[model samples]
Target chain A: EPEVTQTPSHQVTQMGQEVILRCVPISNHLYFYWYRQILGQKVEFLVSFYNNEISEKSEIFDDQFSVERPDGSNFTLKIRSTKLEDSAMYFCASSVKGAITEAFFGQGTRLTVV
Target chain B: AQTVTQSQPEMSVQEAETVTLSCTYDTSESNYYLFWYKQPPSRQMILVIRQEAYKQQNATENRFSVNFQKAAKSFSLKISDSQLGDTAMYFCAFMKVMNYGGSQGNLIFGKGTKLSVKP
Candidate 1:
């Protein structure tokens, strides 16, 4: 079965530095999302993307966070100046439709900011 | 705001035994979707089963089934004839059926329940 694929299974970055997490959603999927889970915490929604633009974002997705679908296949999340609290597992998901359809999730990218 | 709660933090069942994982959610919307996802040590989130609120009948897939009590706000997963491969962290999630521009597709996930199937 086709699945969402994320790059760089794990990443380590210095505080105040930038990091980019990439995802390639299923080819036919029309909706994409980004969610994060702090160690020992519930997964939290970050943002949703459709039509190459942001659809909705949470408080955690502040100015420092940005998402882009630079190409037909690549979706990326960029964090400018990472904070220690930013350490968590970031997941990318996609679906053929919106909330009504089941969203498939990727293995997740573990982001560690020291 | 919506919240999903998985009361059982950890549960273990012997191979070939049946196990049920409990999940309760708080939602005001009558039309919504409930999902159960399994995440193994690989950390890959895999969809186990899904139930739509409007459906009165329970949803089942092979050995996996769900008892969705919309009135009680309870959606529990039941694994029958469980095997060692069933060991994993299961998450209960909620999604509201709305067309609020682009925000309609977000999912609210619970803390998850860790299940251990001992052979």
Candidate 2:
């Protein structure tokens, strides 16, 4: 079974620093998404990407966050300046079709900001 | 707006026993999808099962099954013959069907239920 893969299973960055979390979605998937989960909280949708552009984003996805499908398979999330509250697990997911199809998730990248 | 709610924060079941996790959602759209995902200590999200709102017949995968009540807006997951490996945090998620030129389909997930299948 093909699965989404994320890099740097764990990352620790200082406050005000920049960090880039990367993901490689399944080859055939066209829709990609980024989600965040604070410790002990529900997972929240950050943004969705399709056709190499952002399709939708949540309120939490503010100016500090940006996503890019830099290449054919690589999808990345970049934080301009990390804040302490930004510490959480970031998940990458992809699906063949939008809501009707199952979205496969990656193992997640745990970001810890100090 | 769409929301998914998992009332149970934690649950435990003896090995080989049956366990059910509750989930309820609020959505005006008649067409949607619901899913159950498992996250073990490894922190990997695994899709356990999924149910389509338009389909009255519930979905089942091996020992994992769902009891979906469209009228009540309820979708519950039932794990039969639960094994120790079944211990994990279970999340219920909701997604509204996408319409052409509408917002991208994004999932709204509930606070997960931490399930422990003890030996």
Candidate 3:
């Protein structure tokens, strides 16, 4: 089965540095999303992208965070000046449709900011 | 806004036994989707099962099944004949159906229940 693939299974960055997480969603999927899960916490939705633009975002998705589908096949999330609290597992997911269709999740990129 | 709640923080069941993980949600939308995702030690999120709010009949996938009560807004997952591989963190998620402007609604997940299958 086709699955979402994320780059850099693990990343360690210093505080105040920038980090970019990459994801290759299923080719046919149109809806893409970025979710965050702090250690020992529930997964929280950060943002959803469709039609090459952000469709919706949660309160946690502040100005520091940005997502782009630069080449139609690769979706990327960039964080400007990472904070210590930003350390968590970031998941990339994609789905054919929103409601009934299930979202396929990547193995996740564990970002650890020191 | 939709919220999913998984009351049990941790649960354990003997191998070959049956266990149920509880989940409830608060949503005013009549059309929505509920799902149970399992994350093993590898931390890979795997889809265990899913239930549609409009479906009255429960959905079953092999040894995994769901008891979906749309009226009560309750969706629970039951694992029968559990095995050692069943040990994982199970999350309950809720998603609302919205097709306006080709935007699919985001998923709201609960805290998750850590299930351990003992030998």
Better of 1 and 2 by lDDT: 2
- Each candidate's iRMS in angstroms? 2.0, 1.9, 1.9
Q: What would the C-alpha RMSD of candidate 2 be, to one decimal place?
A: 1.4
Task: Name the 10 consecutive residues with the lowest summed lDDT in model 1 chain A.
Answer: A95-104
What are the DockQ scores of the candidates, in order? 0.67, 0.67, 0.64
**Residue pairs that clash (backbone atoms under 3 angstroms), model 1:** none
TM-score (all chains, Cα) for each model: 0.97, 0.96, 0.95
Per-residue lDDT for B1-119 in model 2, tens only? 98899999999999999999999999899888899999999888998999988899999999999999999999999999999999999999998876662336688999999999999
Q: Model 3 lDDT vs. the true structure?
A: 0.91
Docking class of 2: medium
Candidates ranked by DockQ: 1, 2, 3
Best by lDDT: 2
Which tens-of-lDDT digit does each residue in B1-119 have in candidate 1?
78899999999999999999999999888888899999999998988999988899999999999999998999999999999999999999998877452235778999999999999
Model 3 residue runs over 4 Å out of place are B99-103
Docking class of 3: medium
lDDT of 1 at B59: 98
Could you give me the TM-score of model 1 versus the true structure? 0.97
